[model samples]
Target: MPSTDFLWWRDGVIYQIYPRSFADSNGDGLGDLPGITARLDYLADLGIDAIWLSPIFPSPDVDFGYDVADYLAIDPRFGSLEDFDRFVAEAHRRGIRVILDLVLNHTSDQHPWFQESRKSRDNPYADWYLWRDPRPGGGPPNNWASVFGGKGWEYEPQRGQYYFHMFYKEQPDLNWRHPTVREALLDVFRFWLERGVDGFRLDVFNVYFKHPDFPDNPPRLGLRAFDRQQHIYDIDQPEMFPLLREIRQILDAYPERYAVGETFLSTPQKAARYCAPGLLHATFDFTFLHSPWRPERFLRAIQDWEQALGDDSWPTYVLNNHDNPRAATRYGRGEDDARLKVAATLLLTLRGTPFMYYGEEIGMRDIRVSRSEIKDPIGKRYWPFYKGRDGCRSPMQWDDSPHAGFTLGHPWLPVHPNYRHRNVEAQRRDAHSLLNYYRSLLRLRKENSALRRGLFQPLTFEPRRLLAYLRQDEHQTILVALNFSSRPVRLAMGRTLSAFRWRPLISTRDEPLMPRDGFLTLRGDEAVILEREA
Candidate 1:
């Protein structure tokens, strides 16, 4: 079982803010720390407990901010170190915790450490990165493939050797086996912790360590070249466990601090291993992110994650992020706001920490960016078949103004075309807007103890389209029902729920749903939460 003492992160909701797209305060066409500081009031109004900011460290923008050039300083495009300190202070003043994105697995090739390491074999920092001699045939050292496509090894003539990079060629994997490297990375964590960061979101955490032998991955049948191999030597090695324990020790030194890991191409069972007493507090469950809108698919994912995490572990859920397309564009094909309401209700009522991406509350869809305006390398490589992530990483739609009121200058990416009507200002005025629905759902989750920390019990129903579950505690039991189809559903309460008086608390539709003859009716794309004493 988990510790009897409660941690705020275990029960709180996290709002993910892609700093570059959130708001531009200086009219520079890019969002900055000051821009986010100005929006603290808006986030507080949304009832979020914490804000997880994506990487803001200095970078060459190869893979956006994932390729970090410096661990202790802020990117010039975003702000200075003083601006970050001010942002953290302002967020805490509003009762909102700030979580920074920590990329320890790799660094930009332009980093001083990598630059020195590539100079010569006798350099002090030569062992700081993974360096190896070429194969006997003068090709790459191994058969490992980069995630961005092509061989993972890059021939660097400077040292007459090849360097390893898992993502882009601009990012070289760090040598975690080196003690000096480990100490340097730990100091980075300490630097941010002393600066008042409440937590960290570990990026590609599972791939920090690789097999020492540098062996070739076994071939497997798959669509992508990277997926064509089993990836046994590239990631998820047993060596990661001890490193995580050391990281946990650093975080435990701080009061009420937390760390959540992002597992790349990992299963729930694999993710659970990193969340014991001395490792990560939680790991993101991607089952829901990849699942369709079908009820059975979602039910299976929830049950699988809960079972895998077991009683002693905690789970986190995310429907959309900087990498994936918006949920509204995925699930809400014909029905717009109605589908969004159901998604929000399901996210908050589920048994885990809910993470909401910015602009998701206002039914923001993925903007179609042309090839000429594309900024992401992945999208440029995939072209018409896969248009890349620029669509989802567009600027937030604040209002029906020029550039969606995100900037006075031309925004980095185009705002959604529907921003004229779908924006925070327009939705805040309407009571039935998707933004209001999200606010009410968050408020409901915060007010009800049963919804926040209660045990999850999947309720069985005959209707194949309805997804029902019960969240129960000693004081109350809340039943949540969601209709996934376009047709109405009439669900029978049966003897199990006949004894309790089910009163409607909240629903997607404007009118309240009343039970008649021990049966409840749910309209098309409707969801409801009913309360009864336990």
Candidate 2:
């Protein structure tokens, strides 16, 4: 069980704010710090305990804000350092913690360290980034492909060597092998901590170190061509754990502060190691996000995580993020968007800290970006084979107005065309809207201790389309059931649970649960929370 004594984050629900798409204060068609400040009350009323703002640091927009050019300064487009201070202060006054995104795995080429490192091989900042001498023919040092595509190494004419970059060519991988480099990154963390920020969500935390010997990656047999090569030479290095310990030590100095790492490559067993005692506080589990919508699939994934992480390390759940397509697009029926709320209910009710992506509460579907409209580098390069994240990262639909009320000026990316009937304002008036459902669910989750820290055990002996689980503690045991099929299911009146009297708490329908003879019939897609009675 997680320690209940300290840290507000243990029970906190974090709402992820994709800064560029959240709001526009100055009519620049971009979200600024002040824009976020304006929405604080809306978030507070939604019952979120903390906010995880995506990157707003200075960058060249190579990959939006992932490529950091300056760690300490806020981008002029997002507002200034003073604006951040006000936002943090206002959020804290209203009882919400703020966690900033810290991207230390790589830095934009425009960064001062990268600028000087590219100049020569023996400069003071030369070792700050990964640089190696080229082969005899002067091609890239190795046969490693970047995540964006093509060779991972970029040639520098001035240094006559190849430099490593896991992302776009403009974002060079930092040399964590260098002592000065590690210290410099820690200094960046301290800069934010000293500025009164609550914590950090470390970006690409698992890719901090690579093989010191620079070994060649072996190709795989049946995996995707991209996954064909072993990542042993490039990532999931053992040394990265020690770096997390160091970061945790620094973060421990502050009060009510916590850190979560985006360590994607680690296995369920290995991922837990990053969040176990004396290391990072938490690392999100992607097992659910990666799994398809299947009863057995979800059951197995949750069980695997519990067994892997054991009882000490906490797990986090995220159904959608900026990188993936929205859950409404991926998990919901194409014609009926209300089904997406079923997913939200599942995520928010499960034990762990839940993260809701921007626009997900309102059930916003993915926007369609045509080939001519695509701006993402990955989308542009890989066209017909795979459309990039441009569709998912389009501007948020705020209301049923022009440009979805996101901006008066031209938006960086076009809003979804279906924003007419599926926006926040339209949903606010409807009693059964997705936004109100989320608000109700969130408020219920906050009020129920069992839902927050309950032990999950799935029951599989019943109907194949029925998903039922128990969240129990000594004082209370709550059963949550959902019907995934189109037909009504009469919950089997089995001998195991027939003796107990059950009281209904919340159901998708308005009627009270009839516990006559200890059996209940549920409609298609219906969900319920029941409490045991004496």
Candidate 3:
């Protein structure tokens, strides 16, 4: 079991804010630190314990803020360092923890270290980034492919060599093998810790150290060039273990600080290994994010995560993020909110920390981006087939005003067209709105210890259309049942649970049907959480 003592992150909900789209203060068309500071009360009132802000460091915005040009400074486009300081202060005043995204695996090509390293091979910072001479056949040194597209190695004419970049060409991979490089990155962590940051969300963390020999990845059958290879040599090297330990040590020095990593091309088992006494506090498991809305698939994903992580390790659940399409758009039927409600019920009532992407509570849908208005390089390169991530990265719809009250000026990306009727302001007054449902669920989770720290036991014997699980503790036991189908389901309580008297705590339907005999009948796309004294 996890520690009995209170750990804020383990029991809390983390609301991820894509800073560029959250709110635009000063009519700048882009969200900034000041804008975030102005909205701290809204987050606190929403009942989220922490806010995970995406990258706001100095960058050229090639891949948004992921391409960091300066690790120690804030980007002018977002705000100055003073603005970040104020944001932290205001968030803490409202009893909210703040975690920043640390893109340690790579740096922007425009970074000073990379600029000097590329000038000459013998410079002091020359070894800071991965550089290799062309092969005898005058081609890339290895067969590794960039995640964006094409070869991972970009030729640098000035240095007469190729630099490695697992992502976009503007972002170059760092050489973690070098002691100087490791120390420099650690210092970056220290800089933030000293500035009152609570934790870090490590980006592409598992790929920090590639194979030393830079061998070619074995080929496989797939659509993208990157997917055609097994990625054995390009990512998830053993060297990353020690680096995680070092990062954990730094975080431990600061009280109540935490770190969570993003694992690339990893399974539940791989993600579990990253969390322990000396590593990350948690790692995101994308099993549910990639799976279709099926009962068996979700059950298997949850079971796989529970079995792999054991009883001690904490797990994280996410249905939407900056990289993926909106969950409502992916799961919703035309004009029906039942599916989204069911999804939200599963996310909040599950036995782990739940991460909510901005606009998810309002049932936000992805806005289609025209080819001419596309900003993502991946969308531009793979147009007509892949429209890119701009759909989910649109500005948040706070109200029914022009641009959804996100900004006085034009938004960086278009607001969802449905925002006029489906926004936060309109939903605030509706008792049955998705936003209100989410708020109620969060409040319930916060008040119930069994829901927050209970042991999860899946009712595997249930029918394929029903997903049932029991979260129990010494104090209370809660039964969660979700119907994935569009037809009513009469679910058996199973032999193990039929003896107890179940009382309804919350349900997706406006009026939930109580348990009759040993079975509970649920409407299409409905869910319920029932409590029984332990």
Candidate 4:
């Protein structure tokens, strides 16, 4: 509702909720639909326009909901279909849209389709998954490797065939080339659309289709076996684009609907095409998530995205997700919210739509998981060296209580040890907490049109550590200056924006920060949003 003049996806913020870790109401220590429904008012107060829930479909929990077993049903661990309907209705009532994560690329090995497909080649679902025969001698069809650190091909002795998987062996890649397979997956979208899911975040959508020939991926210099190959044949195939168009057609039939994608190994150039007109509405740019904690790096990622967008496409940015470590830990000093406040300012004031991971508002840090405590298969396979994603997928910290107020029962993953002090309840009471900082930034963007749908204009001013930019429209012009360093910097207003009168809208510093003697002095690790007047 901030910018009623533009598309909601283009002008609004989306909050990512990993349902398993968000909240648990059933005392089962796993988050559920009803748990989310109970927290609608909090999300509404946080000022997000939509909530992109990670996969909640029925699953064997092999991949923690990503290996979907049933596209039309809810996982019993999460709740029932009726509970999901109530959650969506509650979100809609609070002016928050619901975007379900659709994993069209693969399914759990236990899925009925795979069960039948693996029994024999003549079954109705025999071709539902990508099943191939062994090589001439006694090896996999090609040299494709799984993303979770093993050979991508799993030999099924029952069917005497090997199925390809881009991720874990539990997740068998679907045969999107099969007309029936495509139709069945597309129908999954329609089912959820009819159920009032406002949009979908297509999981690993770029890998939906692989090369028909199943050729061996060319080798490259890299860290591990999976990264050693160029992955030219396994991902970003031409066939996926047409499927996106078909999905777009289905979404277009409904009003105010949306669809964004999560491209495996996402790139700006690919996003340019994936978000092209008549295709996806947008695709998550992980550049912001993986970029170094530097001012120039962030500026470069923002500028690159601007150049990559076509005439009809928009840019979406992400800094944290379930699979990545929390940005608060990546970019901030231990127990310091200064850098987080600065990052929040830039994330909220940028040209594109910003995505907030759950618990990011209170500056949640990653929960370190030891090898014995790891739940993620990725962590188990690559422990001590990589340590996997379980650190970031921990339960949300709500209060300083047993299990961080997530549940009375044990949590699926450990809550961050710092949750006792850094949590929503404690931060809610502190005026200067990171939670309040996010609320202020969201409120500022909502009240200012120049900050919401205006064009982004990067300022030439900088000491290399400070990245300043302007957001301008016919109505007003706003300046956002961020100091990435721990030392203050002074920027002179000698030309350009200096011609207009300015007012300070918000800043990370406790004291009022404004220009003095035609110069703006920024505190260490500080960011300020100022509105300029003619």
Candidate 5:
């Protein structure tokens, strides 16, 4: 089923670069488009085919850049629209595609569309947003809670109505039912597509529409009101399909354009459905992000995804992103990158496209931001108990220099203290560093067909202690074996695997796999990839 022609997205590795934390060219303590353009060489050399940037549009920073006020303009804080054009041109020159994160779910209340819509109920733009009358005597329209805090309905005093916001109040969900809203948002796609953006990573696209009835979501057990509800009626609506088809039509009008979605609060089944044929090219499944450091956990995640995306769609996978803690911080034991190397091998060799988060290759850990230093709204709202996402959204570590060489001024978020030893500059010099291991695996992935578009066949011999699988695409079959524990383990697969000769391709360990001794042993926390030799 592989296409004879080149498909950059399907075959290439997409690196997620959080604009606010990637690099800061202006010494203003913030990362910007110019900073990203300057770093293109680094990304190209890192073996990534494309870069998926987080939103850089004009925003009040309520949800960072997710609260986009204007669709066409780039935020002055992140440089102007001119800077973005240059960045795209420079990225394309380096053979690296650019994908922008589109916040299709909502727009900042500061947006002219929302501002005019809230002017009065009779205004032409009044129906642009989901405005409703208070239930009885002025409670929210329903018990639906915002993903940030309180009720999803925010009262608008001037309009004598409540508008729905799935996230913060500053961010209001657009009424997809309104034909104008649909056309306006679809035009956002065309705007960027015309600007030569290769594709889009739709932010919370699944939650774009809610049930027309506006019913109270059922209660569930959780600390925050947002998570306390089952989120049934508020998400995964039927109307999304037609809208997706329309979005697909817009993208298909352009050559080689791609679109992937971030399915907010989605399951493997729900996420996979959005990737069906013409709807979306793929959807981000965060199963790997939440997975524990165990073979059984990853095995289950892989099988569930493989089964979910079977035949109908291609899949997308991620280990970490701006909103979550880094994999190294979550799985690595006391700065040890052994666990990370093992995880990277699994991610890169898998059949689907893998998104490597910024600073992940150097194994950057989450920096703890105390209550006083917390900047993220999500973190600020859930402080003490949850601490907030500022820990994960810290600036990218570049060198041992002050502020990790991210900026001359103070970073908006604190840089991890480990930058002295863990920054990119330090790791790049170490031939056996985690950064180099990623480089090697990425190179191996490109060099091997089975590792790219292959069908996954899980090896369940040592299901709990060792994770193993075969990736076969017609020509070559690659066996990826990883020892999940801290102790060495020997492969015990039956005659099916024993029939072939495994020629070593890559390994996380210092020495390559020596399999001629009639037994294959995986050193502690090691991952090895082997190809069948004819």
Candidate 6:
């Protein structure tokens, strides 16, 4: 049983499964709904409270599932509606809540609403999407660029007008100003809620609203011209808050259901605003995910969040996800797999809900995306500069089998070059594989209540090359210490140990750090969890 209150996600851990990359049951080289259905036990054994499945709704595959063609139906490439029902049922039976990804800011151009909206300027659906007259000289409506690296507006030959698509051209932005569109989307929400879903992870949650006047956004100031623009006209619009409240009202109508918004823009103070009581229950804290591998940077970012967000609202912390490169490639020193496992220990022991992206447990590295293998539109346009998200979105490495056991057919995306060295089958057999470390860390997290909801405070250690902290409650306290450097370090506790009994609960070293007296001497790349003496 979960130690924390059964709030669905109060300091709960969530495993994010990108369905197409998880596993494939059929020989079709693509992961489908039934494929994910087969993986429930894998997730359940990980001891997570919820599973955040990426978009599985019907889409044109323009941006994969992000470009939804129908708000209420499952994509045929995945499986039938009945398959999803079974997935939900099986997950619930295993004590895992299923949270679907809701992409509401836009829809595919192939959607019926968009089809009708583009038919004529006088049609009832004409205002359902953002439409604008072409520039006087017959060009795009503005100089704004799509996130996928092209003009944000696409001109329609039939209507002689342009429509806004903040992302890909196939994904046109929906006009929230339309009462009918909002109501229709709410109906879709009700459709799933009635189907027994626990909640939603709103994708691009902050990007749902736009400037009402269709004004041209001014250029950005500090970063690149793209980063310089305040996005005043494109995103973080003021209207999004009220809509969030309305959405929260809808969600609150259901029992034990929660909503988590993905806001990657800023720190916790900014992220916490999305979690303000009546809106989202939690928002993604992406600061740690973006920071360099430094103990000070990590400590400051986590402390900054606690100070900014207050103690009442829950926080979500993640190391990697479908959008980012694997942490092993980003933070690991070559051949130093222990560093990666130590990172996992920190992630699971942190004071917020931990989100483990699929394949992260196996220490998956970013798949090399060659120019020819590139499929993501963003990567195609950005090329060498960005390389898009395909590298990180490759199929999971289940084994050394062809296609890493993801499929018998050619996968939608190619597997990584490191598949043989790092896969589930090899790791499961190897006692020291990163996968086992993750399982042990997860089990440790579940066994200790203090690790779940205790106050977080950094231990002022010899901050030269080590990171240490303590998780404590009224009856129990655990000290977590990690050596971040490649050299041995001596850390003295300084009379802080006199009144308490102490025992070493966990150590990443092949041998104990040293005799437990007033200090602990740790070797390179080692982490230990210590319990207070009773």
Off by over 4 Å in 1: 1-6, 461-463
Query: Stretches of candidate 3 above 4 Å error?
Result: 1-4, 460-462
lDDT-based ranking: 3, 1, 5, 4, 2, 6
Q: Which scores greater on TM-score, model 4 or model 5?
A: 4
Give the per-residue lDDT digits (tens) of candidate 1, residues 1-534. 122454669888999999999999899999999999998999999999999999999999999999999999999999999999999999999989999999999999999999999999998999999999999979899889999888899999999999999999899999998999999998999999999999999999999888999999999998888989998988999988998999999999999999999998878898888997889999886988899988888888888899999999988988999999889989987536787788899899998999999998898999888899899999899898888899889999999999999999989999888889989999999999999999999888887878888989877533379988899876688999899988998767777787788778899887757667787788999999999844
lDDT of 5 by residue, 138-236 (tens): 688899998888878888999999999998999999999999888888889999999999999999999989999998889989988888899889899
RMSD list, candidates in order: 2.0, 2.2, 1.7, 1.4, 1.7, 2.0
Model 2 steric clash total = 1
As for TM-score, the candidate ahead, 2 or 3, is 3
Residue pair clashes in candidate 2: 220-228
Expressed as tens digits, the lDDT of each residue in 1-534 for candidate 4 is 245575667788999999999989989999888888888889899889999999998888888899989999999888999999999888888888999999989999888889889999998999999999999887899999988887999999998999998888989999999999888989998999999999999888899889999999999998878999998999999998888899999999999899999878878887678989889998977887788988888888888888989457788878899988889879889899999999999899987788999999999999888789998887787777888888888899999999999998999888888989998999999999999999999989888888887898887433388888889887888888888899988767667556778888898887646777777889899898888865
Clashing pairs in 1: none
Flag clash pairs in model 3. none
- Each candidate's number of clashing pairs is 0, 1, 0, 0, 1, 5
Error of 1 at 86 (Å): 1.1
lDDT of 2 by residue, 169-247 (tens): 9999999999999898899989999999998998888888989878678887633444668787898888987888888
- Residue 464 lDDT in model 1? 74
Could you tell me how far off, in angstroms, the CA of residue 24 lies in candidate 1 after the best superposition?
0.5
Model 4 worst lDDT window (10 residues): 1-10
Report every candidate's CA lDDT: 0.90, 0.83, 0.90, 0.88, 0.88, 0.82
* TM-score between candidate 6 and the true structure: 0.95
User: Using Cα atoms with residue i matched to residue i, what is each candidate's TM-score against the true structure?
Assistant: 0.98, 0.96, 0.97, 0.98, 0.97, 0.95
- Give model 3's TM-score versus the native structure: 0.97
